[model samples]
Target: MKTVKQGDSGEEIAILNNALTQAGYSVKEGMTFTPALRETVVAFQQQRGLEPDGIVGYHTWEALLLGGESEATELADEDFSRGALLLDCETAALRAVQEVESGSRHGFVAPGKPTILFEGHIFWAQLKKRGIDPVQYAAQNGDILYPQWEKGHYRGGLKEYDRLEKARAIDREAADASASWGMFQVMGFNFAACGEKSVASFVAAMQQSARSQLKLFVRFIHQGGMLFALQRKEWATFARLYNGPRYAENRYDVKLAKAYAKYAR
Candidate 1:
């Protein structure tokens, strides 16, 4: 749909007004967009963690329609609370890690698909573990199979799934295990620690909703013995365990600390 802002008028405006009203935002009658409606929209956007531009767009419409339930890609406040309770940490810690790991508040790049980063180095190891020579595939698909981790390889966004599909053709289980999935960026190889019987199950859960992702994160942290570090707000220790020893290179610890402070208020 085209952008709807102040002065626009039509069936769409009527629908937007109705949705805003349903979402508990005050809206005036009729189909014309007015300054009052714009203010209400901006307030709604801010409360929903959306870009508060006072323009009704795809994301704003989606938020208004969803009305705080069944947002598969987003997390509710209660999800964080339950996860924090499980980890014996403040909800702020969980929020901090989530923001740092996913690079934003969202866990999914698209509906039914959680954000993912396919690791070529991990794929090499996974193939080797499964006794399939990565060398055979390396010559043809160097981007998806490499002997060591390097920077600047990520395709980012939906394109990462294309890389994952290539790796999956070689070995489904190994491909699933090579990527980090969802808000927590939990490596799929840690599926067992995340309380999944198989990598496929882990991937399925990751795609389901943010709540499922949080559940997996809680399990992964608790089972991997990282919960205590998180509870104590040991940014360095938590970042090292969660993001690897190279966490300092990207300043994940500092980022986590900052994010935590922002959420903790």
Candidate 2:
């Protein structure tokens, strides 16, 4: 993310605009950071205990992305035990996967928002699946509408919500399906596998808390036919399915094995 101020115009500003709106500040969604938006930013900063400099810098961005939500709700050991029981796997196995998938003890990037990665290429494919040509919107939104999956495009952390907000503007349903959310990193398109009726509902459930995410993860593994592999400690097979065909490129299986070993002890 870059520093955004009055007179600047771009996706960062647009993200700021959306943040302000989500934070309960009345602001129009657009790229230009006008005087009105600045006032809202300053007010938001003040309310959030920031410097109120009217500049959307790092701290301001953090506050806005957090959206005034309270602390993230953590999962208890009993939560993991329940998930393991449902999956017929050892609790350590679930713990290992959770540790590897989220790379954190907690799943949220903000108070209420789950960790997310918006895949632009997936958004393009999802739009096409719905008979919507992503190319038509490519001119103005090249960042979030590419035709092929490409690595390294991730803005990472809360900035991923920026990509998500932009993609949502293009097509909400497809945009929702394009993100991998929460501790287990379940793709929204796998809503049915996670026992959700719709992608929108899946996203809603993901935002609920880490425990909800864990339940969805268990459902996904069971429904997706990966329960046996998980229970048997089949790291290679589980990694191939969970992380995609090129899982070897990042040694996901090896990482999973190492993590599982540590927790199983």
Model 2: per-residue Cα lDDT over 177-206, one tens digit each: 999999999999999998799999999888
- Indicate the worst ten consecutive residues by lDDT in candidate 1: 62-71
Residue-by-residue lDDT tens digits, candidate 1, 1-265: 3479999998878877877777887778888999998999999999999899999875565455433545557787866764564455798998999989986657989898899999999999998998999998999998999998886679999999999999998899999999999988999999999879999999998888877787778778878978789989999999999888888999999999999999999
Which stretches of model 2 miss by more than 4 angstroms? 1-72
* Residue 2 lDDT in candidate 2: 61
Name model 1 segments beyond 4 Å from true: 1-71
Model 1: number of clashes?
0
What TM-score does candidate 2 get on C-alpha atoms?
0.71
Models 1 onward score TM values of 0.72, 0.71
The whole-model C-alpha lDDT of candidate 2 against the native structure comes to 0.82
- Output the lDDT of residue 174, model 2: 96
CA lDDT for candidate 1 = 0.84
Q: Candidate 2 has which clashing residue pairs, if any?
A: none
